[model samples]
Target: MGQHTILLAEDDPDHQALILRAIEETGIPCRIDVVENGSELIDYLFAPPQSDDREGGGTPELILLDLGMPEMDGFQVLQVLRRVRDDGRSVLAPVVILTASDNADHAREAYRLGANSYVPKPTGFAELTEAVARIVKYWLVTNHGPPADRSDPQYPGVQSI
Candidate 1:
């Protein structure tokens, strides 16, 4: 597959570094973008047309979102994304919540809010590396995502429902 884009919305700098290292270790050919807070993530995703960032950071194939964040928070981000998706503007990518919270209620609520997957934050670098490797293996390598090449008629464009 061609190089894909992955967006990670996380607050903790240390955790972000760890995840970035882990993703690099996975050796996936992807351009990973990092956002510090939910508001920044929103801006990254919904940048207005003609904005400078719009041309460069195209839609990510997958999103790794932290549930707890400053400003809007991940759940609120998900809610906004759901609404934006419903508006039929763009096909919102799959969002996976990578959080330290092990609360079942949070997981349930995340799923209710349209989180594609929820994973508890790893406690150590080894565990995080493993988690990120698995995520890359499954989502980036094994999974079949939307076809960006519009010339192929057999591949229907991904639609948000």
Candidate 2:
């Protein structure tokens, strides 16, 4: 199997380093693309295929989104993703809100905005590593994700009820 790709939208340099370390400790062969904020995340997702290290600018298997970001927050990014999915303009990959906030309202808002999962950022390094490992194992190894072909009805697109 090819290496799994993950897009991490985090602004804090320290947090980014910690998350990257955690992912690496999981021993999962993954291609991680880090974005500084929501705007950068959107650009990275929608940008044309560049002759870069990325795998042909394909959609990531999972998106680790931080709720608090500058120049368009995670919620705004989710809104754009939902619109794109609804318009059949993009493949809506599973989004996991990985934020420092344990606020119930934030979690609720994230879900209402179509986030597939909400994970509060763990306090300690060890705890963070464990959480990240479990997340990687579950989402990449165990989960049966929706079909990649957007035209397929089984493709899990965000739907507002």
Candidate 3:
């Protein structure tokens, strides 16, 4: 129906490229905006002064978050995201934990902190493509998320979606 925007929070440059390629292969008609660390990710979402000009607009429809990061980390981001959601801010996007971590404890905590899905990063390109395809299909095509408020003049981000 409309264009979708995905916010990806990843630290590694190589992993970032790979994930971007995988998502592109899915052909979901989405705009993928990236942030390198937890701090940048939070700033991007919350529009903290420096990140006020977020390229993808306001909040993304989906968030692909990496668990391990230099500052704030995925858990911390999740904590803030959940808090914003609870506060009824415009950040109702679903967060999907995309990580290399195979630790069950990490997954459990991610879920506990409000991650909608936990997808372990696949090592191979083919596996990564398949995983991204499935994720796109499920989240973009099958799932229903918050309705965009196109009427708001201040929120130009969701207008693209």
TM-score of each: 0.85, 0.86, 0.86
- Segments in model 3 whose C-alpha atoms lie over 4 Å from true places: 48-53, 151-161
Q: What's the candidate order when arranged by decreasing TM-score? A: 3, 2, 1
Off by over 4 Å in 2: 49-55, 149-161
lDDT by residue for model 1 (100-154), tens: 9989999999999888889998887799889988987788778776544334222
Worst-scoring 10-residue span by lDDT in model 2? 152-161
Candidate 1 global TM-score:
0.85
lDDT of 3 by residue, 1-161 (tens): 47788889999999889888888887778888999899988766555344446553655778899999997799999898787767665546778999999889999999999999999988888898788778877988899977756565345322333
Error of 1 at 148 (Å): 3.7
- Over 36-117, each residue of candidate 2 has an lDDT whose tens digit, in order, gives 8998887777654445655445557889999999999999999998888778665566899999999999999899988999
lDDT of 1: 0.79
Instruction: Return the clash pairs for model 3, or none.
Output: none
Q: Give the Cα lDDT of each candidate.
A: 0.79, 0.82, 0.80
